[model samples]
Target: MITKITKFITPALLTLCFAISLNSCKDKPKKESTIVEEKVVYPSDIIPFMDEFKILCGDGKSYNDLVDVKHDNFFYVENDGTTDWVVYKSPNSGVTSRTSSNTRTELGQKKEWLPDTGGKLTGTLKVMHVSTSGDARVAASYAVVVGQIHGTEGHENEPLKIFYKKFPGHTKGSVYWNYEINTEGDNSKRWDYSTAVWGYDMSVIGDTPTSYPEEPKDGITLGEEFSYEINVYKGIMYLTFKSEGHETKTFTKSLIKTDFGKSKELPEQIKTLYASIGRDGSERENAYAGELQNFKQGAYNQTNGKDPEENMVWHTGSETYDGDINKQYKKGCYTEVWFKEATVGAGTPPEE
Candidate 1:
């Protein structure tokens, strides 16, 4: 979603980037359903720890405050002055809410927000509605999974920054905008998305996908068909804002549990899989390894090691031995999670 959607932006707001596991049967349905082990510090505990970093957008003085996560909150607040903040949560992604009051509006991208592509703004705009004098009649919009969000309303609200290399020959209110966050922190999750098709110019550089059904003749453009990758289980939650909720897509990955208790040593291995990060270059791995502590996309695994971000100090806790991405990869995904962790006290940089 991040890659496919963000192409609607100025090329500075987008990011794209990965899988798997297997296991056995045996009605071992206990582990996946439970947040059974380890102490999950409530939002109250998570807020102060998260305060060390400057906010890129929105205002949340504390964790319990309006931290509408993933931009998934479906609060039906009219675009009036009272629609100050969005605070909501999703089971698969975790908790996050942010303030959208007139006081918290940010006009442009943060200086720190940079795309890996030659210092360009990320994503694109699929639609735009601006006044002839230069002001946004409507704020920028975005979606996270099933959720939709509008930019902090204010200013000349110019349709100025709106752009997309995709969706050419479009005039007036025919374009859309997209914003995407990445797994700057977690490793356990991934999103199915693309950065091709639908855009005006289908000349997307780098490894263009050949397997897509609507394979554009030139390179891939950004629109309904462009795709990319995203590991959303932590790190950054990319916001793909389309024009007036135009880019609302969904990814329903119904995960099944596998049996990892079959082996003696696998228990320890599974523990690492759960408590640490996943995928070698996975964002979660980087955050768990404490390498991504400075980035905005939060990390998910906060156990069994030096605190990543959140000041989530490690503490011994009961482990949940469900078939993690590891077992899912082995059996279903046909991939392997080569787990790694820091030595007792040796500092290390993550290597893919």
Candidate 2:
């Protein structure tokens, strides 16, 4: 009887201890989890001068306040390992400014000034990508305008436009600038005269719709770093372009004087380039004089879906996917530019 009682009591005690252990576990508190959120970096943070300007996106969205602001896939800050760059991206087809048909994800200066009261703009950037699909014969195809001095009054034309163009299947591209003539009469008759910096001018094109010209010998490649300074002082425009391996180029032009005032003054390149389009209008005597102007910087996408036959100089027969931004980006039908540094202020005298 004693042995039986001990066995039964022992078994009961074991069962009681097991139940107590389970109950204790149920009464105990649980450890809370800790979650950490990442801090977001904005374009304004990278480029502190963003507050000085306004932005016009490729989708026609305009923003006056850019502090801590960012637009995904269009205007944003990107980290390329060591440095943070402000990326300006736009599709081949999207909402464009009222004055032009090309779409841009670009910044416009809020302060306007005249040619006499000049300003300076500088940028250190790299052309990451240009539209891959476009008619090779079209001058504007596979190209983008990276900088400009745009007029706000008079004919509201662009006095200066810095362009980067690379044909399909070419490893390198051209860097050039165009000066649009302030037409003496109708604005529709205005035309641009292009000058090359590192490669061929806007007049160079392929023989056929798809054929590409020879690769430029000293052309700039994608992801190459280049710097440009636009200094306007005392009605004179000074341009300086510098790259690591290539030659540094400097140009001077007078903003108050007209170089193409008469039809006879039209350059042979312009005459040949615009002959097909019939835009041989001469510029006014006072070119951009007294006109309110501002600086613009970013990816001004030159590629479009317009028929090349209509306007060979401006039209680009590129794939648009019916104005879809995502589809165009996915298929490389867009332009992307990355700027590491930029500044805008009063123009200073050029170094003698």
Candidate 3:
């Protein structure tokens, strides 16, 4: 009886020890997980001049303080493996400025001044993309305005519009500038005169809505780097364009005086380009003189969904996806520009 009792007791003791060991292992502490987060970069980090201007995004969002601000798709910073760039992007159709119909993800200078007490702006940038779907016959299609001088008074007309336009199925595009006349009477009759910096002017367009003109021989390709300087000193505007393997072009214009004051001064290009729209009005004699003006830079999308038949000059009939920015970007129906460097300041006299 005693031997049987000892065997049973030994077995129970072994079971009890096993249960205690399992509970002890379960109570042991676990090692905590370590997660690392990436640091976010802002547009202001790439361009320190964000404090000097305000931004209007393509989605109608406006920001007065850009020091640590960034809009997701419209304004942001991108890295090209080697360097970081401040990107300005806009869709073909979106909320626009009250004074214009086009969309823009652009910066507006905070300070305004007259032509006599002038200002200056410089930028080194590259256009990454323009709207791919549009009417080829329309001058504004597949184009974007990268920089401009906009008046704050009178008709609030644009004095200068530097453009980069590329037709579909073409690898090369034109770099040009347009000067909009401050109409003498009705602002609705104002027109822009385009001048080429590298290739064809804005007047060079396709004959049909789909047909494209010949690809420019001496034109700028997408992603190509270029620099521009707009210096308005003592009521005179001086423009300089520079790029590698391209001609360094320079121009001078008077902001105080009108070059298109007389009807006879209108070029043949204007007559032909504007004849369809009946825009035959001349500019005011004083032009933008005494009017408060400001500088603007970024992607001002000229392409739109408006029918070309309605307004042959300004309309593009591009695909908008009903103002869906994501769809527009995925389908290449947007304008994108990258600026590596830019500066804004009081204008100084050019080297004599």
Candidate 4:
């Protein structure tokens, strides 16, 4: 009897020990996750050039390290079902660069290049919105610069400013580019030479402050996809504009010398467009040949809240609500651009 009882007690003890071992294992911390964490997207992920550039946002926010970071309204990443895009947005009135009246949530290439040495910058984007409130007579009204090559040393003028402009009730807008003159005497005498990329150039504006011209048949509509290449190779700037359902345009400019230095060189568009504004200054004899210049891409707000009567060409009489960002965005007093792709690097030699 004693042997049988010992056997049964031993079996019962073994069962109890097994039960305790299972309970201890259940209490142990988990080493592997059962649910995977979702991957986070960033603006830098959308625009890979951020590694070589720094961003200045409209709210005076400057960002150098943006690998996985983003600002809310000024600089952020947006996803439209399939593809991700980096959005550069700015209010009509806000803190801006010291030399500019416009506010920009734009990227500035940390690398600088000379006109002779050359560089290449490309952008594929669409303009979503531009400020609606502004004096129609103002040249800059209802316009926003999307990309530019800005000089840094001399007058800090821009050699190229790609723009998209539309009137208040227009069904389509104009896609144009301008070359700001590197002035000869003072920087105040500087002006830009407008060139039409697709539709009308910057010169096509309302006859009066409120009257608008007939819409262009080939004008770019808001949210239309377009691409531009500012390729300065061997001191020659080659521009290529591409879009679906529209003609592809290519242009070449000699950056090593001036093409519009004399008053006679000014295009008829410039004379007529800038007639009342008094901006007939000639470009430097050499233009932006050797100036330290850099690439800037994004929404550079051309419209502002300043009194238009003061400087009708630039001073836009737009509604700003005194630089109130929330109000500006709500009322569409802002410029918004979405860049799905961009590249900045050395310019390659054109094919022989």
**Per-candidate clashes, comma-separated:** 78, 0, 0, 0
Per-model TM-score, in order, reads 0.18, 0.91, 0.90, 0.88
Candidate 1 vs candidate 3: the TM-score winner is 3
- Where is model 4 poorest over a 10-residue stretch in terms of lDDT? 261-270
lDDT of prediction 2: 0.93
Report residue 36 deviation for candidate 3 (angstroms). Answer: 3.8
* Tens-place lDDT digits, model 1, residues 77-115: 111242222222111111224322111111122222111
With candidate 1 superimposed using the best TM-score fit, by how many Å does residue 273's alpha carbon deviate from the native? 39
All models: lDDT? 0.21, 0.93, 0.93, 0.87
**Local error of candidate 1 at residue 285 (angstroms):** 15
After superposition, candidate 2 runs with Cα above 4 Å error: 1-31
Q: What is candidate 3's lDDT per residue for 2-44, written digit by digit as tens?
A: 9999999999999999999999998998779999998889988
The collision pairs in model 4 are: none
Query: Of the candidates shown, which would achieve the greatest TM-score relative to the real structure?
Result: 2
CA error at residue 154 for candidate 3, angstroms:
0.5
Write the residue-wise lDDT of candidate 2 on 27-71 in tens digits.
999989989998888888877789889999998888999999999
